[model samples]
Target: MMKHKLPPIYFLHIPKTAGSSLGQLILCSYPQGSQLNCSLSQLLQMSREEISQFKCFAGHWGTGLFSLLDKEISSITMLRDPFERTVSNCLFIKRIVVKKFASNPLALDEVEDLKLKSDISELLKCTNIREMLNLMPSMKEQQSCYLGCDIDLNEYLGVSQCSLDTLDKSKEIFIENIIAQQLSSGLLDINEIFNKAKQRLDAMEVVGIMEQFNDSAHLICNSLGISTPKNLPRENVSPENLALGNLTYRKSGTIPDDVIKQIDELTVCDREIYEYGKKLFNKQLQTEKRKFFWFKKMFKKSERF
Candidate 1:
């Protein structure tokens, strides 16, 4: 029997984007060795020479993996609404980080818990669009400090005396500065990240919005000359993560009033991207309706004849 080798498929996992399910589907499609989860920081500790051989990579890479892979492998990712992404992140922190901390008596000091909870409540209370946008990542980062790998034993305990309040203020300013700069600049520098990955991978790229999953997957299947499944996997927003508030529509699902306000305040560049996405979704819906109408017309014509 001749051996068959499947080509590599790179999945770029963006956090809170239904990436794990997508990753599972890709893993099922490809042979075992071809899929790589790139999120592990331990991979970074490898010698530069050793790391060059890695081909396909995935996971919440924070733009770092773009510099690490070979150029030929196709890169794919899924994006979700930023507001929903923030909420999903919050739930993840509450369940994983908070629960773990509470379980470990040494990890959860009563005073620390009170302070962190207060900070989180204040963050959640933000109603102004600009302030909400500014607060989102800061709260996420604070949650990460508890859950993240970088914190040392000293930093985790009271002995270090790091003020979460002070840190939150500094983080808010830093995030605001970055957001302002990105808005004014009108382009994110993926060049450095891309160039590094390009050295090894022949192609480096991104996939957008979960709404486009089927089309995106079909394109990839066609390009690779692989069999596209009749039932291509769909991305589902978990029930627990569904939007709650005034923006809710029967078909479209709810988005809180505050979330919409935040979205409205997005910079021109970001707003342009969002509008483009909306257009694509609308176009897709129209196409589907036309197909349905065409089929109905054919059925009626056959009956009349």
Candidate 2:
């Protein structure tokens, strides 16, 4: 008979979701069987014996890694508000891309005349969401200002305003193409992604939210029948950082009113996901309240009965 080995605890690390800090916390908490250096893909490729050795595995797990796991393994993910996440992602890119452009002598000339909307739209054209999702974008492009080789903003900047306008139109078309590809490929539809994620959450013993980090951690501890620690890593977004103008946190970028209308028309799936997430959060809150009340009642009855 084959011995049943315990599955590694997985922390599904989505980018920009405070995953790095969380991963560090998990490693500190379970240093014995923790493995932190490898990617999820690398972990998935390991043999059962190799997998059983690790008590915790934390890394970025993109959608593609979902199918690689066995049913016995527990999975956990931390989700944040999508709109806030999108803004964070945008700011991250800006710091890397825009900051570099600002520092470079040659790049300064181009960025000086750069209108935020046009520049961002152009960037979107060059680095479509499809390429990012597929992990096709080169490491340099991912890190640097240049999006793709074919859609260089540096070259476009030298062109006449008329030419720039044409490029803008082309960029829009490219964005549409990318969105179309996303729709076709099943990654672009937010509702589909959410539903799929929900299924994974149901399979998992725990699902957590960034907003309720401490409560979630306590719940996870109780579920695992482990002694809850007095202190865990606690990192909060500072008030100064939360305010606009801070590099770390900026005011949520406004999707142009027209563009929002267009988005409403184009992405019904995202709307559904937004609604579903809101509903799920509410339901979870109610469940937590009921559990708290029941626990209180049980505690009180234990002394009398």
Candidate 3:
């Protein structure tokens, strides 16, 4: 069969949302030299002529790029369960904390300063959600942040907007850089950010759910008019065990009830976004099924004729 021509795609990859898996699928669908996995800064630097060169652009750049894109490009994203995504993201960050502490004695001071206990049980403990958000400032409304930004990219045009450079600089500032990108629109209010993000979602061609990986993958393929890959890739997965001496914190372990509550509280907008995405996904799925049903019926009728 001749391959279906695909529109240029811009994947707004929300962190820890099985984006790596979806990104891999996107990578396989496109031919070499057509794919561009780049930073937001690089994307900002590109001219319209330069941007037109690629059929695929996938990155953590978030919604700021939408202003630069034309109708020809399809924007796609996947969202995970808000609470679950929060825990998983924290675990990934905690792995870095453990590694850095092991490598450098000075890093111990940073961990202590944050009031994070050395034990796995106390790793995510906090007095309240605000305190937790203070530590992982980027974690607040993170999903919505990636999905929404102001139409004007002037604020986000700088290097600090979406740079992960802070990850290496200090544990205190590790994910804080993401906060700047999250608030790129200068929308300090969480509700305002969420409302804008929801509008962005409504504008997206494909809003997928991480839990429904296979279905989401198929939805993306269907949207692109391409065949779905037989094996879906699962990359950057949170490990079952960490390098910190048999640290078992992710899969089998139970996150603290208080921490869970805090995460739930923190991701109010993201939770709504998740539910909204699910409803949107189901609608899209049903529509696709109906189209397929008609195509098959028409084909059979033609055979009878």
Q: Provide the overall lDDT of each model, using Cα atoms, as 2-decimal numbers.
A: 0.45, 0.46, 0.70
Give the per-residue lDDT digits (tens) of candidate 1, residues 137-211.
433221121111111111112322334333332222222233334434755343332333233222323334655
Candidate 2 wrongly placed segments (more than 4 Å): 1-7, 37-52, 63-71, 98-195, 226-241, 244-256, 259-268, 277-285
**Superposition error at 162 for model 3 (Å):** 16
TM-score of each: 0.52, 0.57, 0.77
- Least well predicted 10-residue stretch by lDDT in candidate 2: 140-149
Model 3 — which ten-residue stretch has the worst lDDT? 166-175
What TM-score does candidate 3 reach?
Answer: 0.77
Candidates by TM-score, descending order: 3, 2, 1
Predicted candidate 2 versus true structure: per-residue lDDT over 99-164, tens digit per residue: 546878987755554425332234444333324433322221111111011121222222333332
Which of 2 and 3 is ahead in TM-score?
3
What tens digits encode model 3's per-residue C-alpha lDDT throughout 257-284? 6666766787888889899889999999
Model 3 Cα displacement at 190 (Å)?
2.2
- For lDDT, the strongest prediction is 3
After superposing all C-alphas onto the true structure, candidate 2 shows an RMSD in angstroms of 12.3
